[model samples]
Target: MTMTIKKQNRAAFLGAIALTLAWGPALSFAESVDDKIARAMSAAPSDVSAEATIMDVDGTILREGTNDWVCLPGVGLIPGDEHPMCNDAVWMKWMAAVGAGTEFSTDVIGVSYMLQGDAMVNNDNPMATDPNDGGVWVQDGPHIMMLFPNMDMLADLPRDPFAGGPYVMWGETPLAHVMVPIEAK
Candidate 1:
């Protein structure tokens, strides 16, 4: 009996070691800053000048720019998804506020373009299947998001994601924005 137990323990230990070794790269994987920028830039129009500033997904300014447009890499939302976005300066400022978890209100309207979205994520509870007013997920491709200063911007827009129209995201929060799904080309 003692020998059997010892053999089982050794086998378990070896399996654990093998699993850890297999996950080594995934555990330590961090996208390079340059690669992040490139991926993020792919979300923008090719006509965008090289002068646009590149910002980290964490809101850190990677590169300063003279243009009002700001670009950022994917922030790792959902699983197996990479949805990068290009934002105007106002949107970038708003993004910073959102990342800081602070309440911020502004009347200035702004626009962001996402030309390479992998999948749409639930704006409220990321992991929850309920409380989703904008359906569950978007099955489309590139899209644009608009930040409204107030309810007026909503303009009676449907909150349904499958409405084949614009919908409000983060409707339960003060940072609500209109999500406009674009047909993939």
Candidate 2:
């Protein structure tokens, strides 16, 4: 009987380790800059206006709203239009989170979305310009998505022709923005 119990314990420990190894990396990867933006936008509520800008590593605007801007690195800035992927639920969550006051900053090429700014409810860290505090914040082909808290503030609004849906927030901040990765052209 003792032998059987020991065997079971050993099996359980090994199983736990294996499970962690398999899912740990994927979870870490999902915390990337692109995933952060996608998740934030995915949790946003519909009807809340927001804008996003996507740029390449060199700060070049690859694709802008209705009109693609000149690919001038560190020169041009593009605005995000209504993305088909940005559903109503996503908009609501993001807006609500922002309204609730959550300051967020992410690493452009790394994992871990740090909470920063006066809006942050849990972690009241201020936004810093340091490389550790600032992520890539790019919007190029590798970008997944980039959402803003106040998109309705735009002068010339873009078109959003998608049906409304439910917004869901997973973490503490619902209004945080994200950046997704796409196939590099």
Candidate 3:
């Protein structure tokens, strides 16, 4: 009887595995194009996101826009988090550089909106994966980020996020940018 019970349990487990394998792809693809666009639009103001291009994490263009902005599903090293962001042209190049591990420099100012907030990340190191590695980690809420051509402009801004208001993030790195918080985290 024990052997029969064990066999039945094995069959049940196999059935469960089969069901999961059959339904996984279908469930993953269930998110519609309209849904992706809506999620991407949540990153910025209605005026900017409404006409901005909506792109997915895999560079799939869900919606083409008439403006110079590109909205994505998320940013940073956080896993499984959907912190969408609306980025202007320069920010896009910055992101591309970050993704490719290449040097990035801009001659003009850049802007990125994350009104929906953002995931936790190291303030001084963009490549740092572990938050407890002696780096200042911050999870900002409803913020706008500005990138400058001149690094000297960031010399006076505070680097501490707890200091409140605008501060410098990744201050010691080439990817340094100003973090302007619009609301409390």
Task: Return the top candidate by lDDT.
Answer: 3
| Model 3 lDDT, residue 56, Cα | 68
> Which residues of candidate 3, in runs, are more than 4 Å off?
1-28, 76-79
lDDT of 2 by residue, 43-101 (tens): 22222212332222222222332211111111111122212132222332222233334
How does residue 18 of candidate 1 score in lDDT?
29
**Which of 1 and 3 is ahead in lDDT?**
3
Tens digit of lDDT per residue, candidate 1, span 1-185?
Answer: 00111223433533332232221121114777677668767877856625666655444455665666767665422333456778774565455454445565655688888878646566554445444565455444778888877767586887667777778876776677887878732
lDDT of 3 by residue, 1-185 (tens): 00111223433533332232221122126778777788889999999999997766656566777887888766533445578899987787676656555677887899999998988888888779788788889999999999998999888899998898899999988789999999875
**Quick one: ranking by lDDT, best first?**
3, 1, 2
Cα error, candidate 2, residue 54 (Å): 21
Worst 10 residues of 1 by lDDT: 19-28
Question: Where does the lowest 10-residue lDDT sum fall in candidate 3?
Answer: 1-10
Candidate 2 deviant stretches above 4 angstroms: 1-85, 102-137, 141-178
